[model samples]
Target: MAKIEFAWELGAHTGHVTTMLPVAAALKARGHEVRFLLREPHAAADLEGAAEIPREGAPIWSGPTINANPLNLGEILLNFGYHEAGPVKALIDAWREQLRASQAVIANVAPAAHLAARTLGIPSFEVSQGFHVPPPAMPAAPLRDWEPAPRARLEAADRRVLNSINQALAAFRGNPLTTIGDLFAGRSMLLTYPELDVYPERGPSDYYGITKSAEGKLVPDWPVGDGPRVFVYLYHYYKGLASLADALARQRCSTLALCRGVDSDIKGRHHGGSVYFAEEPMSVSRVLPQADIVICHASHQMTAQALLAGKPLLLLPTQLEQFLITRRVVRYGAGLGIAPEVNNPDYTSALTALAEGSEYASKAREFSDRYARHERGAALATMIARIEAALG
Candidate 1:
């Protein structure tokens, strides 16, 4: 049996943790020894069966815990960039000691994980839920296709931030390349999003099209309301749904806003006739199955769960990259995409059309059926088999 070490940098949110946990559990069931290294204190609860590697001395950043809203800009940027080097290095040092006897390391997309695994001279597997990062062959692209001079300038600033991040990872790993992909030769990346869901399939050899199963934390207990109940999920640390919340309330709909932390500033904002206030984050599996429609900002967990539950979506994507991805979902008949800048005048009207429409629901249901037939367990099992073979 192979000794597998799974490492992650984020812990509070359950989406990614949940994704890798089941895989680790499956490996253990198959006679493989599994160890997990987490970088967050909040992630300890999620690491029930696995060994918990504390990050108290690690150079990891523990920024304010907030919903995945645009208001939490600092946390989002820190997450995207490995700027908090102290905590990361500390965590890596601890992991190095813990993994000294392990056969293989499964690193999440975090650049630090990659560097640590390399430093330990172990093969690393990159598991991702988002778009396959731009290969070293391609430079960072604009998040949106059509932006003016000012927006273009802003995007350039964002690119600089990412470039510095690349440089930091390279410096830490003693590599000069500006991209993470350049550092890992012969590394395999498993893309969990289904091929049919992504735009213009490039069909990369290493990209595996695996559909993840629906696993949610809370049970669905949507209150019986007078009108159509709209569920809006804001789980991102960089994007906000205040405008969408306002628009939903203005349209006279009963809205359930699922937020993560104690940010009461945006609560009680009226969209049109709809009342907007912060509600606790609910399990998409339990909530999406009962909602008439879902509104979100292109979170993979929320979007994937919504699609699986066969619920139509109204995506209000703020990031240019997210906008492009979510636009595909709308084009594919899975949902509607509302540009982040749309004002109250037009926002309510667009949302009304989506909520009243049935086409999106039909298409989402069809995709869910196809995905369910593919079976998440089989795909994960195959991945475990491959990992075992690689260890040998």
Candidate 2:
């Protein structure tokens, strides 16, 4: 059995853990041992039999959210190291010793993991949800297709970040990381999103479609009844949440709103016989099948899962990363994105379009069909073979 190390030390949220679970499970099932060096121990509780790397000091993003402006690698690296060489060095060293013995490594937004693997002369793989990168080398405009001026700004920012990465790599006598493209260049990338959603202009990678968690999490209690079942999984702390909850309450449907950090007062205001609010842990997979419509932040993981259920989404994105995904959903004709500055009426109108309309549902089903045909069993076998080759 080959040893595989998985490392992530970015956000406190569960996105990274959820994305990696299926791959790790696939590896373990093949008699390959998998271990984790997670920034948040709680994030990996669902990892089953995976062992933890006995090290500390995973970079933490204490920012309000994980989205980086302009979606550039330099901004992301700076956010993690704050332009400080010491922190960047520490970040790399933290993984170096812990991951040195592994035959291969799979990482999620952890540059340190990649750096460590390079220093040890082991192959490194990236498991991402599509938007963890900067602009590609190709000229295709990303997302909404930024104008020339804004695109220039983003390009300049990327150059600055690449310089920083090079400086860090040079400190350890490692090959200089020439650019954001160079960072991911020639590496085996495993993405969980469609090409339409990721850097479409980039070279081919293993696109495994949307993956589900190996197991479900704390699923909120489902409401009983045959009325249109609406599942509300949104950012509880968003300023627009109160108005959104109120809008849901006004709908002639049975709603279960599970939001984090929402005011109890807001829940009390909207609680009714048809609308219930519970901020408990929820198995999105289990609950998604029962949901007729899902309203949530346009996180890659949640958005992909919602599409798998063939449920149309009313995405309310709080950051650019989410906005990017939302744009693709709209292009796919599967969902709508509500602007953060939108009033209650606009938000409710979009929600109505998603719930009352059949067009979105039709597109959603098409995507669901495509998702089902991804052939996870084949993907797993292919991945194992790749891992074996990498080990060789």
Best model per lDDT: 2
Model 2, CA-based lDDT: 0.68
lDDT of 2 at 255: 81
Structural similarity to truth (TM-score) of each candidate: 0.68, 0.84
lDDT of 2 by residue, 1-392 (tens): 88887778665566777677677777877788787667876664633333333323454434332334434555555667635545666767767778766888887877778876887788988777656654346222344455233666555655665665667677778897655655555564555666245556555565766544544456655555444788877767887877776676667557877676678898787665566777655767688898888888887878877887899888888776777787789888998987666655466677678777999999988888877777656766676677678888
Please estimate how well model 1 matches the true structure, expressed as its whole-model Cα lDDT. 0.57
Residues 162-281, model 1: lDDT tens digits: 455444445456544443345444565555455333324434555444445434355444443455788877653524456555566556667766666525556633423354444433
lDDT (CA) for every model shown? 0.57, 0.68
Please report how far candidate 2 places residue 330 from its true position, in Å: 1.3
What's the number of clashes in each of the models? Answer: 21, 4
> Candidate 1 at residue 250, lDDT?
55
The residue-level lDDT of candidate 1 at 375 comes to 65
